[model samples]
Target: MKSLATLRAVSAPALAFVAGFMHAWAIASPLGGQPVWWLQLMALTLLVILLDRCRSATAAAWLGSLFATCSIGGSVWWLYISLHVYGGLSSAMAGLSVLGLSGFLAVYYALAGAVFCRLRPRGPAFRSCLFAAVWLAADLLRATLLTGFPWGVGGYAHIDGPFSALAPWVGVYGIGAAAAFVSALLAAVLVRPAQICGAWQPLLVVVLVVVALGRSHEAQDLERAPAVSVTLLQANIAQEQKFESATGVRDALEWYATQLMAASTALVVAPETAIPLLPDQLPAGYLEKLRSHFATGQRAALIGIPMGRIVEGYTNSVVGLGPGADEYRYDKHHLVPFGEFVPPLFRWFTRMIKIPLGDFESGAVGQSSFQWSGNRFAPNICYEDLFGEELAARFRDKAYAPTVLVNVSNIAWFGNTVAIDQHLQISRMRAREFERPMLRATNTGATAVIDRFGRVTDLLPRHTRGALVAQVQGSKLITAYAWWLSRLGLWPFWVLVAAVLTVAGRASRE
Candidate 1:
């Protein structure tokens, strides 16, 4: 019996690590980058069971940290390519950097697990609810604090999962909270079969209700505005040479210019930094020629370029040509830490690397959407779609809410990795949350058009240089998520989690 007990103790942490890896797969399967929602629930259920079995908060915290380290570290392992291969960090340093970031993020889950173990209630229902609240609190904190990189949040998996309908009503964090609650309830029933009588009914009802609501959230529910024909340019520029004056920069300029000038659609879009040089640095007539073509024709273009001078600070911006005549500009708001902007004391880190244009000023939150062809187009630079609340802010004034969402990205830094697929799923989730179609124009991959229901209607093959032309229909109706989150931000979730924790703590005393 002592030997058996020792074996169990030895195996528990191993199980936690495996569960975390599987959870990462659920976020975006390593095989194809598609989300496996059932896998996520199963992995999370295992996590809850592991936490429940812990005798002390310290053990639970350690287990949670291990789980998160495996999950987040596995999910973003591609960062190694960018850091070592591109940024010129040594292989060891790059790997250590990735692990360090993952470990830092895992601290939040460790705290959550400790809290769950400390305040666990006697009743299975109460315990499950308590776990859900704490899990959400941790997830929210991860997404909110220290510039917030919520990459592997469980909610992204539900884009095509049973809880998809809940997106428009509760947003990603809320869906993650619901998933946590359900996972914990299942774990509770499994751990204590005697409580199945009370737990099974709610579980069954919850599943049915979510499935029903999700089924009803069809494309038909979204009020489709007039269709806009768009030409999305994908210039397969190599990251190593993207900023090089002679090679990638010149190629990007020539290719995108040709496509933009020839595109006959109502609107044309190029990926982030399709033009590697600033306006003043461009060959004299190059910028004016494209602007002249777009300036008068009915067809306008949204071209991504580096704007501003060294004195005033540079900006990662998209300039509108054609109809708006450079009047409509959208600058990137959510700057990527380390990659886009250096944090305090990180100046040394940036100096060690060889990344150009590493720092750029941030654009204002809730900037005005681009107006053209009777449709409002909102632009979000790469990874900006991860923050739904920032996007939600644009929906505050319904009359001016974006009809079409545009994402311009150059993820070549990550190479032809799963980052492309993971980013695509993020865009799809954003589309479902707001009931608006997403137009993605990227350098090298996932240049596609996604409808309001988060269905990809068009796509360009990865590593290809081409144009994906499609008729994108916009949505006019505001989802419940867009309406409230736009007005209150993530404040309601804060209140809900606090209230749940309070109730759970009170019930534990009873």
Candidate 2:
């Protein structure tokens, strides 16, 4: 009996670690394909099992923290490549930095576990609902506080699974909540048979969710325009040489200009910073020549260029260069910490690197989408596509909401890792949320067109220099997720969390 108890104790922690590690693997790409989503549910079930077995809130918190540490550490290990390879940080320091970030970020989940243990219900259904609500609150907080990093959330695992159908209706966090609820319900069924009767409520919620998704009007009877021809230029500019005036800058100018002048399409989009210079700073006659060429015809050129004068501060911006297009510019609203703009007191840390163009001003949020021949193009720069709520905010005014989405990125900083595929997942989620086609142009990779259903219809292989030519139809209908998020922000989610906890407390008392 003693040996049996010892074995149980040892296996629980081991399972916790395995669960976290498997969760990490489930979201990993090019290494673990999207179909490993089942592993995520299994991992969460194991974590819930561990939490349920713990005698105290503190123990549950520690277990949750351990699981999160393993998961996040595994998922973001590639950050070592970015910092050491590109940012010039020492390998030891870069590695320690990643470990430190994972440890710190895991606390959100730890807090959720701690809170759930303290106020858990005797009835498994209420407890499961409480767990789901608390888990979502943690995720929502992680994605909100300190500019938010919501990568590797469980909902992302469902990108190709049944939970995906909920994306257009509830967004990633909502999908994540549903996933957590289901995972906890599975744990309840396995660990505590007495509570099985409570399962019907969550099951009914699932039924309603499915019926709602089935009856969704987001994709029905929307105006479909004739496919527009788009040419995405992926110049494959090496990050180290992109700004050097000697060869890198000059070569990009010559190469991209040559391609643009040669192409005939309704819209021609270049990856972020393809111009590498502001409007007033372009080499003499270079900007004028491209403008002159694009002015004579129906073709329009939308390229990423730095915008603003020396005194006002420059923005990482994309400007429309051709005639009837020059007035429109989309400045990046979400600036990447350490990459675009160093956070307060972190300037000293940024000084350790040799990267250029690290300091940039932020653009106003909700700027008007660039109006193309009847279709509005909303542009988001690198890392901005990670925020679905920010993107959803643009849908409040449907009349002015973008019909097509455009994202331009320069992922060469991470260099030839799964970061490319992970970024592609982020874009696909956005495509589903708004039911809009995402047109992409990238400096290094993932240049493609995502249709309304978030499927990649056309793609250019990563680390290759090529242009992708494809036709895409615009979407006019706003999804249910977009409609709610644009108006309520994340208030509904917080309210749901509160309600679940309140009901769980009453059930436990009863």
Candidate 3:
């Protein structure tokens, strides 16, 4: 038999690498459109098994940190495409950048793992619940603290699985909690004979949930008769050429304006930063010519344009261009850390790449909802739809809650990778949470329409330039998840996590 020290040293790193590899594949598109979800469960199960193997709190924390850093860093390896392939950065710098960011983000998981080890209970079931609670807490911190970057949450893997049914009632984080719980239970069963009784528990859940959610809710439940007619414009504008006024800018303005004139839909929306320049910087009569055409129409056109001046700074904004132009305007709220504004101390790193427009002002959280054709439309520029709570807040005032969610994104920066599909999954999750329709208009890819049940009713091909016209539904009903989370944000879920750990501790003492 192997020595105890030999097993301890060899097992942790091997487990970390295996978990990381599985986690990385869990979000890739090769396995499936939504990635392989079983891989995610497998990874989480391995992680819990490793944590349980850890003899000390310090070892557990270190193992968690190692797994997270490797897994997260590997999963977001696509950043290399953004930096080395597109941003003109060296491969070394791109790799280091992804690793640095992943390492920084892993601290939250590390802390949670440490707490779990320190407060570990006796029963495997209770311990599993405690592990899940801590994992959810870690994910919550990842999404909320420091302006939040909630990428690669395990809940995303289950978008196509039984956990999908839980979205309408619990939101993304709650699903994540459930995922972690199942993983912990499976991990215990993998090693302990005591857990054998419940070893097949997760399988039973999968069978029941798949059957329960088999109905096509998006098709039968959502209103299709009175669908809000929308025309979404995707310019296929190249990121490198977006700002060169002579070539990219001139062509984009003409193409979009012509598309706008031809469109007959009630609402027409262009992709994020489709204009590629500040309104003031555009050649005189350029905007006017388009405005003149759209100025006298029943159809309304919304264009993504950079507005404002250098003294006060610019804003990544969307404005209504056709009839009733004064009614609709949306400024992006969730600014990307390095892409939008240089993180407080990270200015030096960003100097390597030249992004056309950086450091724009953030729009207020409770910004005005655009009203058109008896439908309330809430616009989220870029990946702002990734945050479910931010969208849930609109449901607080049920009277004015957004009936439709519109996402305008220019994910060209990330290149034509799984980021497009990942973002689509994010919007789909939002639909389930709010029971509202999501219409996305993106610059490079994933231009699609998702329904109240998180189903993509229509989709445009990735990396292609064209219009995706769809009749979308508008919802007034706030899901049970939305109603509770709207008021206190993530606190209710946080409280539940704390309560679980508290109970576990009490039981351990008893």
Candidate 4:
């Protein structure tokens, strides 16, 4: 009996780690395929079951933290490749950096677990709802605080699942919250057979949510603009040699210049930093020649190039060329931490790595979209699409809302990993949320056209040098997500979480 009890104690922490690992696979399976939504729900359900059995709030918190550390660490383990193999950080330092980030993010979940244990409600239904609310609050905080690295939220798992229908109405967080509630309910059923009589209420809520978000939220036809012929360039430059002037830089400049001059599409796009140097830094007449060619006729090109100098501030910017396209510039507003800008007290850390052009000036939030061929093209840099709320800001003005979403990225820093598949899914989520077709131009992979329905209509194979020439249709009508997120921001979700938690607290006291 003593040995059995000892075995139980050891198994709990191991089980938590396993649950978190499973959660990571559910987000973007490391096995290299689409996310399985059921797997994610089951993983969270297991965590909830474990939490319910914890004797103390502190114990639950520790278990939750361990689970989250494993989940987040497993999800973004590719960061180590960028840090050690590419950024020149030592293997030990790279491993610690990834662990540090994962642990820091796990704090949110730790708090949630503690709160759930402390405010344990009597009824299974109310208790499950409370757990869901607390989990969602943690997710919201993670997505908002510290520049928001919400890479592998639970909702991403459901992009191709049943709950995906909820995306246009409540967005990713809402879907995740619903999944949490269901996970807790499943846990309640297994862990609390005595509370089986109270299951109807939670089950009813789930039914209502499904009926409301799924049935009422059917896809309606949006105003369709004329199709635009776009040529998306994917140069597939190696991250190590991307900035080298003699090899990667020279080849990119020559190849892109040749392609730009030869393309007949109405809109032509190159991946981010396709020209890794400034205009003046080019070998003379390089910028002017392309501009002069695109200056006339209806054909236009949106090329990614850096602007400004070291003395002032350089920007990761895109310049539009062609008749009505010139004079149009869109600077990247959302910058990546460590890669684009070092955080406070992190200057020492950054100096140890070798990321070039690590610092950049940020652009305004409401920059105008590039207008060409009667379609407004909203541009987002690498990982910018991860924040759907920021993109919703443009929907504040229906007249000027982006007809097409354009993403230019160079995620070669992480090499050939699930990051490509994950990023493609992120872009697809944006396409689903805003009901706007997404056009992606990447340096290495997932260069494709996603329809407003979030389906990949055209795709170029990863790690290949090619151009994706396709006809893309732009949408005019806004999704419910765009409409509300633009008007009220994340306040609705904040209010939902607050109200649920308040009710749960009052019930616990009763």
Clashes of each: 1, 0, 0, 0
With a 3 Å backbone cut-off (N, CA, C), the pairs that clash in candidate 2 are none
lDDT of 2 by residue, 121-222 (tens): 766677788889989998898888888877777777777777788888888888888888888998998888766778767777886886678466543777
State the lDDT of candidate 3 residue by residue for 1-510, as single tens digits.
Answer: 569879879878888877976786676554555756788889989888888878888988898888888777766777788778776788898888888889898998898888888888856666777988999999999999999988778788777777777787677887788778778878777789677676566546645764564453333444332467899988888777777888888888888878978998988989898888787878788778867776675777778887788677888888776655464678888888777887888778788876657688888786767777778888888878888888777789878888888889998887777777878888888887778888899898789989887889998888888999889878877677788888888898889888987887777677
Which clashing pairs does model 3 show?
none
Q: What is the full ranking by TM-score, best candidate first?
A: 1, 4, 2, 3
Deviating ranges (above 4 Å) for candidate 3: 2-8, 198-225, 325-327, 506-510
User: How do all the candidates rank in terms of lDDT, highest first?
Assistant: 1, 4, 2, 3
Q: Best candidate, TM-score-wise?
A: 1
Q: lDDT score, residue 34, model 4? A: 74
Residue 391 CA displacement from its true place in model 3, Å: 1.6
TM-score of each: 0.98, 0.95, 0.92, 0.97
**Comparing 3 and 4 by lDDT, which wins?**
4
Of 3 and 4, the candidate ahead on TM-score is 4
lDDT of each: 0.90, 0.84, 0.80, 0.89
Residue 18's lDDT within candidate 4 is 98
| Runs with alpha carbons beyond 4 Å of true place in candidate 2 | 1-9, 32-35, 193-197, 204-208, 309-311
Model 1, CA-based lDDT: 0.90
Residue pairs whose backbone atoms clash in candidate 4: none
